[model samples]
Target: MREWINLPELGMIGLRAKIDTGASTSCLHASDIQPFQRDGEDWVRFTAHLGTLVQRRHRCEAPLVTVKNIKSSTGHVQSRYVIRTDMTLGDRMWPVEFTLTCRKTMRYRVLLGSKALVTGQLVVNPALTYVQDKPVLLDISGAP
Candidate 1:
């Protein structure tokens, strides 16, 4: 199954994502990864590729959650940078953790793993793709 998702915190919208129940961690396509400290806190800056066909790029920075050693589908273990950000699917918004890596060779730029699906309380109907419409942004600033 697949869906269109939004990463508002990353300023990413309507990105195609493959819902992969087999994976335990979600992932995002990022390149030019650099780790640095900000105010003594671990942080990372990177360029996110919007799509495979186009060269559109988005520069983003976020607090580093951790560097995790993940075993890829190809059976290779690699350390990847992790970050927590808000994800929007349809009208629902929630915080999700993602491992940033280069996925230029993959068809989808984003991969929604089992953890994220469980956290979002999403039940995937394998027969459907893009079952949810594009997310509509909500104001949660508590100011009118």
Candidate 2:
């Protein structure tokens, strides 16, 4: 898998993602985050920024897995909401946990960390971008 990723479940495709081996967990940029209880389960509502050029926006909701204090690249620690979802890169698809926070100032909205890399499944070429063919945007009008 290349650095970029496709999150079909989240209505995101061909999205540029930063591969950070030093980080233990992945994270996604989200805005207007709101938490609520749904059917006795913790749920969160947020919006994801998709694509680079076109910059599409999608509203998403997921069950909150946990709250974690993540150290940012600048070494600042902040609490974020973690949610599990499937991420597709190349021909592989797997469940990954993504901490949700406002990353509006970051270069890329998605960050793929060590946990999502798995064991011996991916090789990162720091000098490369979009090693795999970009994914076509799927109709996620029905997605939740």
lDDT of each: 0.91, 0.83
Q: What TM-score should be assigned to candidate 1?
A: 0.91
lDDT of 2: 0.83
Per-model TM-score, in order, reads: 0.91, 0.86
lDDT of 2 by residue, 1-144 (tens): 236678777767778888888888998989889999999999999998876566778999899999999987799999999999888988789889999987777778898889888642887877887887766664548442
Instruction: State the lDDT at 108 in candidate 2.
Output: 80
As a whole number from 0 to 100, the lDDT of residue 40 in candidate 1 is 100
Residue 124, candidate 1: Cα error in Å is 0.6
The per-candidate count of clashes, in order, stands at: 0, 0
